[model samples]
Target: MAYYIGTNGLAAFSVINYLHAFMFLAFLGIGSTIQPMISYYYGARKPEMIKSTIRISELTVLSLGALFILIGFFGADFLVSIFGVASDTIADMAATGIHLFFLGYVFMGINFIYMTYYQSIGYIKPSVGITVFRGFILLILMLLILPYFFGINGIWLSLPVAESIVAVVLMVYARKGVMEQGTFERRF
Candidate 1:
């Protein structure tokens, strides 16, 4: 799709993708920190502690998400420039892609948090389901369907759309579990 957009598009996408990789790793770090702590608390039947851990982790992840949005929105040109994007068109496209793509970060962190929470509680099925849908299934669907109508903007939007959908699904599932358990507790 970037190639279809032109060399500038490809170049801009490359820069945005590289930065995205780093941001993804940072999100992974959040998962790594929360997973074990949540697991240990859950194992001990310490529901309060588990809740506290989740609260803290969610706050941290949300902060990071906000930072990503800020950087992507305000610093896109600078970020692209770091990748040696000299062409005005490439810089502009890259900057736009960064701004649009980082919108996903708003909800992406919550998806990660929920996925890690499910995994920590040993609810492997939902964790795997969320992972598969967000990382592959929904993404592929959006990539295939959206671009046909909206063009490159659609392609850029695919991640946010996928993440937002998965987040909503997970939130609904969590709410159902909470309703059954009566205290935001894990069902499994």
Candidate 2:
């Protein structure tokens, strides 16, 4: 990616990758928390408990995501400087990347929860599909296609766009499933 996008792109990536370390770990923890609780509730045949757990988990994840976006948007330059990247070009590029890259956090938390939810409920395909599509196929396709069209900004935007697309699809289906209002249906 650095080779394709050049020094500035690499710098941008480096900054986000560093900051992403903690956030990613936290998100993983939050995401992983859903599975056992969900599975237990599902086994107990307690539909209401399942719905409540989903709501609470979604709220927690999305709130954390929003916090990450706020951090990225406000701390971009400071964050870049933390890496000792003094060049204005590199700093600006990294800041832009932070601003854009953080947007993925917005959708990612929800996606993570969905993945675990699907898995806990024995819906193996969607769970694995979510992981593969965002982390692999969609992301790789974006990495290849976006930079060609939107340049470095395209690279920064790829994860967010891919996450958003998957999130939208999952959310729509989820809305019609047990998580939404009305009686719980095994939709999707």
- Candidate that would win on lDDT: 2
Over 1-188, each residue of candidate 1 has an lDDT whose tens digit, in order, gives 74459766777778888999999988888998899997898788777777677678768878999999999999988898888876888888888888889999877888888889889888888788889999999999999988888888888899999999997876677635633353535553
lDDT tens digits, residues 68-122, model 2? 9999999888888888987888889889988998999989988888888878888
- How far in Å is the alpha carbon of 93 misplaced in model 2? 1.0
Q: What lDDT does the true structure give each of the candidates?
A: 0.82, 0.84
TM-scores for all predictions: 0.91, 0.91
RMSD of each: 2.2, 1.9
Return model 1's CA RMSD, one decimal. 2.2
Model 2 pairs whose backbones collide: none
Question: Given candidate 2, what's the lDDT at residue 50?
Answer: 81
Q: What's the distance in Å from true for residue 145, model 1? A: 1.6
Lowest-lDDT window of 10 residues in candidate 2?
Answer: 179-188
